[model samples]
Target: MEMLSTISGWIWNPLAYVALGIGVLFTLLTKGVQFRRFPDMIRHLRSGGATEGGLSSLQTLALSLSSRIGVGSIAGVATAVAAGGPGALVWMVITALLGSTCAYAESVLAQVYKRREHGEDRGGMPYYIKYGLKAPWLATIVAVATLIGYGFVFPGVQANNIASSAELAFGVDGQVVGVLIAVVLGVVVLGGTRRIVKVVEAIVPFLAVGYILSALVIIGMNITKVPDAVVLIVSSATGKDQVFGGIVGYAVAWGVRRAVFASATGLGEGTFVAAAATTTHPGKQGIIQAFSIYIDILLICTASGLLLVVTGAYNVKDPAGGFLVEHVPGAVAGPNFMQEAIDSSLPGWGAVFVAIAVAMFAFTSMVFFFYVAQTNLVFLLGERRSKVLEAVVKAGAPAIAFIGSSVTADAMWAAGDIGYGILGWLNMACVLLLTPVVRKVIRDYDRQRREGLDPHFDPGPLGIKGAEYWETQKEPVKEPDRV
Candidate 1:
């Protein structure tokens, strides 16, 4: 545990600044496309239709959201508040707003550099780094890192959270919950990517909507306390609040760290799923992906933060030891904080409600995690598929999920942080190096929109090479139906 924490600290201590800088840089390079193309994001989201082998824009959104809006939204928000105070919530919102641009840049590059594999579109940081930059070695490193991170290290965190929440909600044992999660996940994962996509597309909306509505009910019930909660968040974030003024640095650090962990702006998680979409233009998919950051941090994470603050159901821990603020004296930082918040308003329901929500959210996220790992596995073995290697990932993912549920949350979280930090470092470097390519693509996309024509990608004329998939295309891919 100590070693894991040490590694995590080494990776993440400077990562927040790195992530922020890249986000700011991308925003400038793209001329703030996340904001300027806000309307187009919405229109293009509905415009993209899926071909026989690819996902529609909305389906890709759901797959990405499945990973984005998982335990991070609930349990991650609780940890941020407990460690960084309500002020952390403010920084989380800031990270998402800026990071949305990073999301746009990476997603655009992913689409531009995508390749067809096994009759399905497959691309991401690895593909772009390999094909776009012509560095197969660096791409191999990225693919291996992604496979290890998403496949083995990260799933445990989600599984740990789900098991802990379930154990708290019901008296079920962690091992039992772990086994159940592995079994359920195995059934879906064995069915491959299409099954995973269909399942996520069905459940992501319901999970998001249901969780948000519950938050609204809690907020509406405590309408009188809303202003005070908002004030606490703002003042604490700026080091103005009397109670939380001392740890303003911690607020920014934890908020940005947790927000990046939650929304995965530049980590290349969304880039993999984004590359799987069938869209007219790379920018359209990029814009849709940017909007997902809003759904994740702006709506879902905010809901979690508000639930904790308004109800005073959280305990703030001082990094130096002891409590800075302890609204719930015995409660540690986790989903229980939100569960307690819900219970404060609706008796006997918080644990059960949070348990179910976390289960579904974590489950969908685990599925997406497997897809990311599988995608990278394919990238690693280009034109050489090994059944033994495939079976290892197929079986190992669920095995880790089960093991994660039975272990301590602290260890799992530390491991997850290290994985995210490493991926961020690798993918960010690739994104920054390829900024010129992204810039040209964005300009092309913007020019077509301004000319009153739906954008179509033709990489050759733009001097963008390595987009072999788009180079052969003459017109936009046809849509199957709106979904």
Candidate 2:
């Protein structure tokens, strides 16, 4: 346990700084792409509905959101508050605000450099890391690292959380919950990206809305406390809180970590999602993905944070130890934190509702994590449409799930934290090198939009137009008609 904690600390501590720096840099370099494109993005994603062989922009966003809006939103908040203090919630909002821009840039770069393979369009950090940065070796390193993170460590953590929570809430055995989760995950993963997208599209909306409404009801029940909670968040964020005991720094780091974990900005994993889109223009898909960060971080995570703070469930001391803790016997710390908060105000069924919500939230994330691992594997092994790949993924999912349930939650979190830290450094390094290319793509898209031209026009081979990196790596000019 000590070793895992040390390992996780080593990974998370340094990478947090790097993630923050890269996030700030990209937010500045891109002229707030997240802010400018947010409204346009919302409309674009909604403009088309899902179609066969392809996800509509909204479906794509929903799928990505499903992966993000899980334990990270609930448990992550609890963890952050526990580690840092109530002030952490304030930092989370700031982190999400900045990190969402990074998400925009990376998603755009992924779209710009995306390629088609096996009758499907695919693109992500691997593409940009290899082709855009001309660093194939580094790209390969990141790909392998990411696969291990997703395939091995990440699922175990997800499973453990689910099992622990289920054991508490339902009196079901932990192993039973683990096996059930594994089976469900196996079914979703075997169905491939298209199937995953379909499932996410169906579930994400209902689940997210349900979670938010429940949270709002809790907040309304505690309506008188809302003003004080808001004041606490704002004051603590700015270091003006009366009970200042490292609260400012604690809040900032806590908030940032939760936002990063929830939205996955700079993680480079979400790009696989864009790779599966059916859009002619990768830019369109990228734009849609960028918007997902906002939905996940700004909306979902913030809602969870507010619920905890407003309800006074942000317990300062408990074994779970955070603003997101409660006194429920069978409740997992985070949801119980919120549950207890609600229960205090509403009584009786509050914990039950929160328990159900947490189960669904955690379950959705488990499926999403599997999809990330599957994509990384496909990238490394060369996309062979056979049962071999499917078999490996299927087997791995359940195995990881079983391991997850058996392990301690803290140990699982520590392991996941380590993986996420390595991923952040690798991903941010790539983003820094590719920022210019991302900028160029955005400029070109904006120009085309202004001039009433198709935004999907290939800008390469004509001196690689906007991006300096692409300018130097230009392929030989082909006949204009030879797309």
Best by lDDT: 1
Backbone clashes per model, in order?
A: 0, 7
lDDT of 1: 0.91
Clashing pairs in 2: 82-322, 87-251, 88-251, 91-255, 92-255, 314-323, 325-337
Candidate 1 lDDT, 62-149, residue by residue in tens? 9999999999999999998987899999999999989999999899999999999999999998999998889999999999989988
RMSD, candidate 2, Å: 4.6
RMSD of candidates 1 onward, in order: 1.1, 4.6
Candidate 2 lDDT score relative to the true structure: 0.70
Candidate 2, residue 327: the lDDT equals: 34
Per-prediction TM-score: 0.98, 0.89
Give per-residue CA lDDT, model 2, range 1-483, as digits (tens).
Answer: 889877766777666666777768877876777777676786566455443444567666777887788788887887776666667777777777777767777777776665555555566777777777888888788878877777777878667766665665567887888788778878887787777766777888899888888878877877898888888877767878766444666566556766788778778767777655545444566678777777777777778888877766655433234433333444445555666766777776665776677777777777777777766666666666657865776678778888888877878888887788788878887788776677776777677778975455365632343333223434521212110
